[model samples]
Target: MKRRHFLQLTGATLAAVSLVQTARAAQPPATDAKAFRAMRKYANLSFGRIAYVDRGTGDAALFLHGAPLNSFQWRGAIDLLSPYRRCIAPDFMGLGYSEVPEHQALDARAQLEMLVALLDSLGIRAVDIVASDSGGAVAQLFVAHYPKRVRTLLLTNCDVEPNSPPPGIKPILDMARAGTLADMTAEWLTDRAKARATFGAAVFVNPAQLTDEIIDYYVQPLVSSPLRRSQYERYHLALTPNPLAGIESRLAHSTVPVRIVWGGSDTLFPQTDAAYLDRIFPRSQGVHVIPEAKLFFQEEYPSVIAAEARRVWGMR
Candidate 1:
């Protein structure tokens, strides 16, 4: 049998992690590469121009993506939930098509400020948020710093107060500090098979999901120039000093409804974080743990994200 989808409070954390792994078919979900490209628009904020997709209309739902990834990660969720909310997915500066000054500070705090500026540019007052990976760290900071601007939060596999930048990421961080991560990934451009293999092990549950087109879409711009490569390295280095530190009290005090949908099998973030997140936030709905999903499972399981998001927002 396939993994039975489940959601429960932090109380049943152990049982939830013990659930059987899901069977993931190998086909990458069909993404309209052309449509996503055509829809891209830039918001000229104080920092720089941020590339984002603003779709549908209603209360806004801001989707924040992870490191080594950009707004493109949320395409599926936007596709599924846009009709119910104004889905806004922005590529963090230094990632995706977003352009920032070469001297821009690339850190969670910087990202939080950029978000404020982005929302200001759009004349938005508040947002319902869905964030993954490093983006989750930024989301937490956003809540602590600007609690009034958020309505609800949905977090996928990512950093938490106690486990920010999970230990497994050390190697990548080391590579980034050595100024070699971008160069290492640049090889993916010539070796699509290698790209799929690396991402399959790290992010995707199904290797076949990474097609050549997806590889090109994700990697080309990342290493297209020396500046982008430097920014890529800087992006990873900014996670240090534990950005989520000192915000535990603020997060604990927040009234924003929070939900954690984590990938139990993700090597970078431990399964316990789902419970930690559940325990930290007073308004936590629960933690939904997918045993077989990897770090970037939102790309693999957008429906799960959409359902949890709708549930949080009370969408029909």
Candidate 2:
């Protein structure tokens, strides 16, 4: 071939390659980090600096996560629901990305206090709460104490009066007290295989969904330092039935609309508790059961969570 022809062919090939590269670059990153990093915000509460995600606009939907996990648990649900309303997921003090000291006690009440302060900082008067596990306990306290501040309550597989620190997790508490839980947690954080075999397999219906990046997101804070591990232990040791007991009577009379989302396969918290809750909160719309799920069903079925939230909150 002639030199001129060869040069023309090379230039055309280079241009095509450049275009392909540009298109690939323009495609959005597939991870939750790519979608949510920009929404990160912080509220410097009395307890510590609380990291939270504030996304979209309109009325607020406050998301509270359970122990050993943080606002990261709600990312999938938030991503699904943010377009219709403001979504706020906070990192409980001593967990997630929050800037907190190790020794502070993070019982249900302290968590509740931090939550209220964070809400005040954001100037949010009321919210529709979607919570799970220990977060469900915290949500119950929030709605019961500050009835006016809550428009709706959504709870799934949470601690209730007489069942706080459900039986299935008792061994974990023993481990935490024995000083082995943190080390084991640290091991899981570094090893995806261990994380899947232990915590991930037990909690998630589909353990394969727990990606390495997401595992890092959940475990990084807990294993960040010795202080963090101590903080986690302290938080667990502080758990009791007292907080739920204090608010039990009040929940029955609460005028706020409530909904119970239960994981049917959850051996830890029985389905009977769902009925118990429905009876306590006469205002409850009724329980919605997800049969294939265990503990963290919200992660797997975020669309259902979003749908029920919209229906209850009167958001289309």
Candidate 3:
């Protein structure tokens, strides 16, 4: 069957499951809402009323998600990181439950501004940043512009330079500009099998772990009309001049320690880019390559990634 048809069928299947649940209970469970509330209280910041989850209390550790995802991406890692430090994960503007401002620039600079506003609102003077994929680009810009706020940097599966994007991503950007993003989202984001395959292609050490529930969770928001457009815009912004275009120059002069964790099997951004990042951030102390993992290392191997975070933070 065509990918679009498959997705439509899958949506029907999910709807059936919801109906079954409703028949069993008069009201839906509040587990997800309650969990979201916990995250919100920990990372409550001002740019918008972002949904987040916070765990533990001590030094701050901020987890940033990539395009099309929210704090939900860190669901597996949050519990593990919370015991060691205050883990703050926020849904960036235009993603998750965060306010999707219609007039917002949606560029790298605008994202950095929101980050700064968020930190200032929360009165968080400093933090250790852990970023993946597009989030890494945002974190790089944050570190470059506000070095004082960052104590350590952890970059994973990200391209630091504007010219270094992986092979096919540029073409996807071109397609988005040509008004093909909606179709692409329908193919890649909404389809359950495709979504599972894409996530597996990126970061599954064990493909068996890509469960139906997980795939449903990832694609659920995209089912909404506005959320899908917000996600598409994020990809469009990434194709332009990155906010961290001159990141090497900034990192070269930065005093904060840096570390890189890469999934050797990452099909999006290859492991070769890790060396380029290490060269740029000379003070980088370690580079770990998780052999079986893919781009989304935290999801595939949260325990390992959490342990690495603790080690990087000197909590281990």
TM-scores, each model vs. reference: 0.91, 0.87, 0.80
Kindly list the per-residue Cα lDDT of model 2 for residues 14-50, writing each as its tens digit: 4334433343233222328645656778887778888
Q: Which residue runs does candidate 1 get wrong by more than 4 Å? A: 1-30
lDDT of 1 by residue, 1-316 (tens): 1122133453434443332122233323534777898899999887888899999999999999997888888888888788899999999988899988899999999999999999988989999999999999999999999999999999998898888778888988999999999998889889888888886567888878777877777887789899999998999899897999888999889999887888888888887887777777888877777878899989878777777787678662
Number of backbone collisions per candidate: 0, 0, 6
- Candidate 2 error regions (>4 Å): 1-31
lDDT of 1 at 49: 84
Clash-forming residue pairs, model 2: none
lDDT of each: 0.84, 0.78, 0.66
On a 0 to 100 scale, what is the lDDT of residue 190 in model 2? Answer: 61
Candidate 3 displacement at residue 37 in angstroms: 7.2
What's the lDDT for candidate 2?
Answer: 0.78
Report residue 129 deviation for candidate 1 (angstroms).
Answer: 0.4
Instruction: Tell me how many residue pairs clash in candidate 2.
Output: 0
lDDT: worst 10-residue window of model 1 = 18-27
The Cα error of candidate 1 at residue 36, in Å, is 0.3
| Candidate 1 collision pairs | none
